[model samples]
Target: MKVKELEEHPTFAAVLPPATSEEYDTTGWRAFKPVVDKEKCTGCLICWVYCPEPAIIRTPDRKIEFDYKHCKGCGICEVECPVKAIKMVKEV
Candidate 1:
């Protein structure tokens, strides 16, 4: 698939290689989830870099995406975002 098409039609497991985190679905482990505010996001990639689970995905357009299946909702993304673009909201 072309880069543009891949960005538009994101497939979580395809983005990363097989690994420890990828082996299991960790989505249910978090009480909260990080939501990005596009208006405030500068695409600085800070959150993407600091995520321990490496759940953040940086798109070709410089925007950010998430691999929630492996995300633990550790809140590091929200805390590390300099622009405060990421907010951790309670997961319903």
Candidate 2:
């Protein structure tokens, strides 16, 4: 069960679909959700830049929005926000 052995196995590779597909929804995997405080936000777009899923969105009005449908809630936005506007709250 070594990492290298599993990667080289045809059975393992064939069974697991590629995770790079645009339609692969990862919202179910989220343990926490990011919440943004609009008052505290300065429209810096830092969260949008640091997001791996690129789920943080910028509106036409220069406001920020979240795409919870595909957001994995990895907390990169919360960590990267210089204004501390985004917070990762418990999913419950």
Cα misplacement distance, residue 23 of candidate 2 (Å) = 3.8
TM-score for each candidate, following the candidate numbering: 0.75, 0.72
Report how far residue 24 has shifted in candidate 2, in Å. Answer: 3.3
Lowest summed lDDT across 10 adjacent residues in model 1 is found at 12-21
Which residue runs of candidate 1 sit more than 4 Å off their true CA positions? 1-21
Across 1-92, the per-residue lDDT of candidate 2 in tens digits comes to: 89999778676334655665657777889999999998899999878888887788898878799998889989888889998998899987
TM-score of 2: 0.72
Note the Cα lDDT for every prediction shown.
0.88, 0.86
Candidate 1 clashing pairs? none
Candidate 1's TM-score reads 0.75
Q: Could you say which candidate leads in TM-score? A: 1
